[model samples]
Target: MDKSIFTTNAALTPALGYSTMIGLGLFSLALAYIVRLYLVRNTHDFIIADRRIGFGFGVGSVIAVWTWAMAVMMSSAMTYQWGLSGLFWFVVPNGIAVMAMVPFARILRRNMPEGYTISEFIALRFQQSKVATGIVTVTMVFGIILEILINLKGTSVVVSTVFSIDWRVATIVGIVCVLAYSYFGGLWTSVMTGTLNTLMITVPAAIVVVAVYDRIPGGAEAVFSAVGAADQRNLSVLRPDAAAGFGITLAFGLLAATVADQTFWQKVWAIKSRDVSRTFLWAGALFYPIPICLGMLGLVGIGYGLVPSDFGGDIAAVGPYIVSHIGLPLTLILLYVLVILAACYSTIDGASAALSSIVAVDIVKRYFPGTSESKLFVITKLSVLAGGVIATVIVLAGIDFTTLVLTTYALKTSVLLPLVFAILWPRTNTIGFVGGIVLAILIGMPIYQFVGELSGTLAIVAISGLTVIVAGLLKPQAFDIASLKDANGATSAPTAGE
Candidate 1:
């Protein structure tokens, strides 16, 4: 059995590896929490970190959030399974997503200076109170479930593969740690831990890329050339393969997300200034390319005969397979720990904190007013624990990866685009918002069911069509913006710009 992860060596016993990993992962996480409580707390400190993150913190946290295990593993699967064409869905359009957000940062920063959440901005813009509540609830609850599930499965596989643990137990521990640190210090905990997790994520990913290249003969070019000859269309955008042919599906998902989702907006809102936000944009833009690089490792592994021909070809399977085949050695024990830590907690904590913030800021506040910031922070921290537990249970309850990915970006149609229009354009009313969400969901479910899941790009297009058509007919129920913002007890800005 392959026990050690570097050079030639015997595998560590699964039980021993699993135990060590769990113990180690927990230790680092506990330390991260302690750092947060000692050095970071206070609502402002936790929420936005005094709005002056060092480039290291900003860049690392930004990259950490984007490099969820699903994106890393699945992107690699694309390379191994689909070749260049897979890169299009996995990388090209995703690049466009990063690009799309850049200008979006300008608009968001300029318009809603005091906006704390995407729902807050949207609720004020549309003068519809329900929309804010609905958007936050959907994003915080549904979004996190998918995020949690993906991280659990993908990270657990890494934890198991690296430490030789059973994926099931690893997932349990993974979810628990994610919640613990997140709840302990909230975003403060997330950011502090994100710095370490950043190193864990980047260095190992870089090393693996090198290792895979060396393992597969002449490295990247050879792998690309071999796969290119095997399937030329796999390098192209249009493929006859009924699934993942980046036509309407990819386009829809992108459009829906670009116009609709609040997470990006919330991040944009959180940045210190337009220049800082602009600088922050570089983080995601720079980091997204890493996936394309890491993905090539899987392609090389496939070419070198490590993975099978029909290799399940999702985001979840590629990396572990490559890592599994590497010559094991005792020297790699520390490196292996770093790789799993990078994979497991980096995004998990951010996701937990963000989800908690949404619930505490959006859901709880809606039902009750006069919420003190300190109390709200406490509630958010507690919600982090609860959210992690929920995610863990779902993973244990048998939610598969495919389900998570398919449902993840559909919210663009459901909440994002409509909300965006509601904020930027006056025509978007409560009726229009409701109409748009219903239309988007209706179109989305059937297509996901039969025509194959639409990409974020395609989802946006379909929902936009449905939303615009319905909104014109509804003729709009006007919202009172002043009253809406006042009722929400938000920072009332001057002319929607501070």
Candidate 2:
């Protein structure tokens, strides 16, 4: 491995960084315009695409939303730091987490066919217990906000690092670009743009991975030798050390992220019922190669003996660092940037779309009751704009990407068991559901922040799970699940296609 390449600070010009952001933003705007011109006529079309999305679009949207910028950066960083075990721990749970939502989505879509948000269902399930519904709503809102912040933060860090642009400028540009399109077509735009973004992410990623490996002096074997020499465990797929450190934490945390998130739930309603299971199954399968390909860059970093210091002491910067320093052609470098930007753009728009659903159905409609459909429609778009502004402000505050991700995961994980019980178990009562989440937040969050990640996550799941079970046993109440059919009130007439 040549150490000399590390000395030169090679980077793309700031113009390229700004241009990429502007270009993607304009592209998303075009998609939104098309959607508005033809598809989005009301809140239903805007929020959930009239609940008629088919398999192709559904699969693409799922893959795009699931491929967050953090997934690209962190997958490599984990492998770079913890070896193959790190990649295994991160990638396996991630794919499975999305697939795990299949049963939940199937049941929820069947039971509450007209539902728009998970929190809305929680309200109905708990007999509209304000405390229980509020907990889930707040958890989801914060989770989505964190989703926006993390993707923005990830894009900013990568752009600034590889293009010599200021992180603040990158952050603001990324959010504004996403909001420009997301505000117009809502979920319709998100799905259309998300499918395109999926292509940008997957195709470019495969090319870059092969290019990097081909460009290496000793090729795959040399890279392997270099990595193995540093630490033999880097070659092992089943390193017990990584399983203990990353396996348990990511397994539970990632599952919580998918199940508790309104993003997946929004898709549940947006997609056709028959396509739901297969869409998720294919989406999960399609998602595997992305992180796997990106994780190889972590090995490339190790092969070249690059350390965190080379990338400003940020492990999450490993992917960008490799792409910039590895001497790839200028075209491939730009392609790599497109991949990151695409991941960031797709997810930001997806989260914003989900946020709009919550605002329209859960908050504004629920509270204002008499608010007209026209007003509800307008409020939904406005909520997305508001979310973009809030997320941008927080990103400018300079929070660490890893810290934001872990904290958000912890918060989401706290509600995992309680939420699952609410959806699946008839005996899950309001007292248990509400009490479990409250206790998890009150107790588990402190441990998460102050104690260990694993311990904190475990504590949250344990506390919430125990509370729900005990409450159910003590005060067993078989909720009339059939009544949930009318939970969202009178269903609107099906749109033209449906």
Candidate 3:
């Protein structure tokens, strides 16, 4: 329990902690500002990069944005607990969700080319129902909250575990860094910074794997054997408990999360028309590895006999738990900090940009009909700042991280199946859309609140989908997909930025 360097149980010195955060985080901010200066010509550029993102940037942005704190930390933590089956269950659902969005991205581009967020699609699809828009907006805002929670968890873990810094200070530092550059460039800034951060994340991850390889007991074979001994089913890809419980729940939950998330929708709009499928495919393929590689740290830790109790029972501490045991040099720890910062910033900027677009396009213009584009642009920046501040307050309040994550996913699941059906099925009606979501929340949340996380999630997806299908059957009404073509009255005029 002694906290000193000689004991190999010390917090990162204050000097090193502050220096690493400022060095890596601020440099990314500076580079982001420069990119914004060249790319940010108008509101469209700020929100969706003028809807002309190239394939490389598109893929990088998707991977970076989606690789939130949960992707790196929780993915490993689950594997630490559930073993190989855990990693398989976690990564597959997360990757599949992004890949599955490819066709929808093409459809959105072909129809609502000027669309800024998924809410626009909802508003257009259910023109007569402000309730639908309201529900979607609320759900998207919750998605923003989910983003904040992710970075909050990442920064808090790195700072608290490594530096002995109060998690609040880390939260404040992260918020300031993300808001500063995001305020300037929006999605263009996110994509460019994401490209850089991807390198930062990739290099460190690769280095860690090589550096730790020799140290792992029994090497890969020993790690697998230890995992199996720890839990009879741990090393099995089809571990029954994982396959039936966490796997099924996470599959439905993540599918809902990706579909309902404005961050993903914004990416869909940002990339070039021809590159939509390729971008998503690349993003999914590239991102799938980072988590798996990181998850290896957990298995190695298990092989070395490390346990959750070492990190105060917080599963997110799995990565740090392993790192601490490696007796890594301070330099390596600094590199680890940079990796965490990269993950945090990528998602924070993406969420800020996504939330701003929803506020600008869905809320501002809808309520204030005569709002000028310039004013709307200003409002978007303001929303980003406001969201960062709100998220900071929530993080500082010290909410239960696990519950926050599960609750948000449950809320999202309530609306997700209905939204998908509305978009893909011609017979899907507003009655189905609104009523199904309402009924799902009424029934599903209680399940989440009382029964269990997986049960609650499954209930929401099942009930929502069933309601949409049943309502459509009872009062079938085919909607012309072409009706969405000019939902926003956007013309062929190129943006000023373009």
Candidate 4:
């Protein structure tokens, strides 16, 4: 592919990119301050928003956290590669993963209403077994770190590509901006800002999509025909290549990403109990269009006969390439940058908040029973700062996005079935839960690297599930689900009104 054919005559100024980051940072900081002053009374309110978030914010937060940088970039990249099939395979599992959380959220919330982290729930469920708790806590921590790293990486890639700025500077600015707000308001900051961020992402994205179609010759139909003429497989959603490339890997990987990620679990407990299932359902439904629309840009790239080299040897840059090169007005181009920024900010803050929950509830509260509430609160905020620093360091290391994503997915997948068994099945014991994750990590990850994604993912799930079953049958010990209610010794603080 001739990269010169796709070169843009104009690019965004570094001034615009840096100013946007600084402006959004100050705005988020102000928003967090207001929220803290008016809504937050103590550690509980800061960490989980007093477990009273309503449907609107709940739905918005779920969508924002799920939207992250990878979703924005990968959806388009996949479509650029596999056409309609890429969009189909990438999007279906993405939505399904969020919706799948419904039942689990319902069950866990009813049983343990004061839960702050999944690791905390597992600790209680497994009767305080150190091995089980340690495994889950480590995974949750790792998951949040990966979330932060990926979002930072995503934002850096987009900003640097469009503005011709250094990616390292973009990453540093991005994480610092997010931490500025997130460190103050915690989950409250995440949910409230996430609601606003959702609008930032969707509205601009819709306009960009319409503008792109209007600008192209003969509109959507012409693009469709161009893609089809290039390759019939591009138009077919059920093409073998799409399924082989994205279907199996994303199906399992995305599912694990959602089910195992603490970001969703934080929302599960933060929202009103009655609103849990509906929020997830609505969020999942609403989330479908954002990715699908952004991904069309990939199809636009394909129709234009642009390849990875056209986007600086990175297919993930295809979305930005089409937006910047297609002769859209400067205003629309900036709005597209806002879309990427919003996605990155919401998820980074959300993941940081989730990490705070784990540090306070799973590690501090669980291990240091005598810690004061004031100290615990400070530690929680510090955790966000610590997470941002750690993720920033790793992003500076310049790891491959796809490799990091797949590896995180595999690690998360190793524990998914075990978590499910622990939640819904009474016979699921610590031995089974611990053993399942241990064996999956030892056996499944190597296969993932050496053999194939589909096969390795299947092995992880099967090994984890089967290990739980065999252990359960050999040593049938039923856990009392109702006991979880009393086991939840969540520390409370005064409400804002109190």
Residue runs of model 2 more than 4 Å from their true location after superposition:
6-11, 399-407, 490-498
The global Cα lDDT (0 to 1) of model 4 is 0.86
TM-score of each: 0.82, 0.96, 0.94, 0.96
lDDT string, candidate 1, 1-498, tens digits: 111332323455666565555665686667766767575556555555455555566666666666667666767776666665565566766656655666556665565555556665655665546754575457546666666677777777666765567788988877766666566665656766776777777676677667656655566677667666656665565554524454346545554444444334445555566344555567657776677777775565455544453234444565665655565333344464456556557677777766755665566665554676667667766777776777778777775656555556655446656655655455566666666766666676667667655443455445755575467457855544344434545632111110
Considering only N, C-alpha and C atoms within 3 Å, which residue pairs clash in candidate 4?
none
For model 4, the superposed segments whose C-alpha errors exceed 4 Å read 1-11, 399-407, 490-498
lDDT string for model 4 (279-397, tens) is 99999999999999899888888888986776789888889888888888888989988999999999999989999888888888777877787888888889999999998998898
Q: Give the clashing pairs for model 2.
A: none
Q: Pick the candidate with the highest lDDT.
A: 2
- For model 3, what is the error of residue 159's alpha carbon versus the real structure, in angstroms, after optimal superposition? 1.4
Global lDDT of each candidate = 0.60, 0.87, 0.78, 0.86
Off by over 4 Å in 3: 1-11, 400-407, 490-498
Residue pairs with clashing backbones, model 3: none
Ranking by lDDT: 2, 4, 3, 1
For model 2 the TM-score comes to 0.96
What tens-digit string does per-residue lDDT give for candidate 3 at 1-498? Answer: 111211244646766777777777688778877977788877778887877889988888888888876577777787887888889999888899888888777777787777777877887787647898888898899879778767876787677777787778878876887788889988888888887889888889878765665555456776667766777777778888887768888888777768889999988878888898889988887888898888887776566566567666888887866665566766676776777788888888888888988887778767776777777778888999998888888778876667766566766887888888877898888889998888888898889779987778778888989999999999998787777775557421223442
